[model samples]
Target: MTEAPSPAPVRIRPEIAALPPYRQGKQAGADAFKLSSNENPFDPLPSVIEAMRSATAVNRYPDASASRLRARLAARFGVGIDGVHVAAGSVSILQQLALATAGAGDELMYAWRSFEAYPGLAAVAGATAVPVPLAADGTHDLDTMARRVTDRTRLILVCSPNNPTGPIVRQDDFEAFLARVPADVLVVLDEAYAEFVTDPAAVDGARVLADGHQNVVVLRTFSKAYGLAGLRIGYGVGHPRILDAARATGIPLSVTAQAEEAALASLDAEDELIARVAVITDCRDRLAAGLRAGGWNVPDAQGNFVWLATGEQTLEVAPRFEDAGLVVRPFAGDGVRISVGEEASMPAILEAAASALSLLPEGHPARAM
Candidate 1:
């Protein structure tokens, strides 16, 4: 008993100990519409389900390299198989890229209010995270970002249609910024919601690559538009050397054979997926328009969600929506992100928004101009 009592506590990294684990969007009750996670609202296609079922190898390990999926993505993007990498999700690949490039005494830069995973990923890599603030309109301030880069900067994440805020990085603007960055620094264009983007002016990663930007990587996911969130498959396209680094750092065999089959089936049914995306985009437009009419300062909203600048009222208003049977993601000091989910969820969402707007203090940014 005395020997057991003498055992000391285990030591852990202080920075990691202080950091919180990634918090997913809140789940809703059975009667509630969960628009919190920015998940695709559509059910998986029947063919996709069949393909997953056909991948009946629970006892065996998946392709460690996800070679087949990589080849398919390579063909689609006009890249060599070596230029593509797949993972349980694009976010996982992102963490791998950060691990491969940055470490203790290094820096990873990204815009603030971006995908919530960035800061944590950098921290886990023992790298310093430098977050540049977005402009008041909620778009990345790329010019400021370039000036902030230093010799210590190893990686930079540019989340197009920046998550939680939804305004995409314009194509011309991004290309110019890419020109400003040093070639040695890795630049990742995270386009998780790319399929939902209707803005013709937004950055198209493939086009950027074709233009000979070698240091840039484009991350895409099957989770959103393809309705494969549960399967968790995503990919990245970049130079072979860069992708090889990512693959080297990745968790072995994380992408399941079932996930790969589902993704392949999803590609086979791309036409139907595109049609579903159109429906979601339509719903997003209607929701944004409704919010704007009710005095909310909705942004460009190029993704499948709308941003509400509730400012200090964020915490106050979020509960109202939750109580109203519509769950949304609220960033305390910033605003709320409402995903474009089921068509039937819209009325509840609109009603909750109108009520929340009414409750805001006079002249709040979320108020109608």
Candidate 2:
């Protein structure tokens, strides 16, 4: 039966109404390698699976504070119990931090082409998003980001090994940038991919926090390195007061008991989990090197992904990879991000990248010098 068309959707914030919903990585067909999300290609540890099985208490709500998981993370980072907060995912913590710090008329600043969720989080808080464009090599131009800050700026996000385009913010550069930012302004070091980094010069957020960056927060996740993406658990380490503010904004009991148990188990099995990360990073390096050898200007990828700055050709180039049974993430008019997927997918990736490279116009920036 034809019903009255739902009266133009209920009134909502104009900014949020204007914003686009967050888009996830495309799912691949059964025969295709899903390289769209920068996810761990490894299977979960049996220990983690067993923990989840034992944690089956769907009939009851989870611990609101996730105390045990928080305690473990706190001990690992030498932080106080109150200073550690666990949430559904590190991305959820980002939104919590945004809501806790920024509001209407305030500003949430970050690098462009970062995690796609950043803008929507800011909009949800009724805060203005100030996105500083990435440098030509797709790294954050911290100097300019610091300059962009003003009295209205309440929060800043620094995504190391910047997503989509891979490059870590060097320790020297980050410290210099931090010095210029006001002490009151909160800076979140989004290190979801920290485990994959091999660069000695990269800014280790844990070290930076220990060095006493009072306003700094370090966010990490079991979703990426620990293969807990399906479980949805991550943690944040920061000043107790800052974490308290974020904790207050969180939805009670959103983190499930199963997720918490899997996280604890993943922590117990961290050594083996990290070895899997090493394999992915090794694969990432090989992929980046192969792309470079083929005259594609791949960045010094420290994450489990490689960026193909296909530029304006993204729309045309991404589908070619898809045709080769590789589903990749493409940011139209910007570039394509190809995650380092299963080892079996490597040959397809290289072949697709080589073909995409041949499709680029003469003198495209993505072409090697």
Q: Each candidate: what lDDT?
A: 0.92, 0.92
Quote the lDDT for 62 in model 1.
88
Please write out the lDDT profile of model 2 over residues 309-368, one tens digit for every residue. Answer: 888899999988999999999999999999988999998988988888888989999999
- TM-score of candidate 1 against the unseen true structure: 0.97
**Least accurate 10 contiguous residues by lDDT in model 2:** 4-13
lDDT, residue 5, candidate 2: 43
Q: At residue 338, what lDDT does model 2 achieve?
A: 93
lDDT of 1: 0.92
Q: What is the C-alpha RMSD of each candidate to the true structure, in Å?
A: 3.6, 2.5
Q: Candidate 1 — which residues are off by over 4 angstroms?
A: 1-8
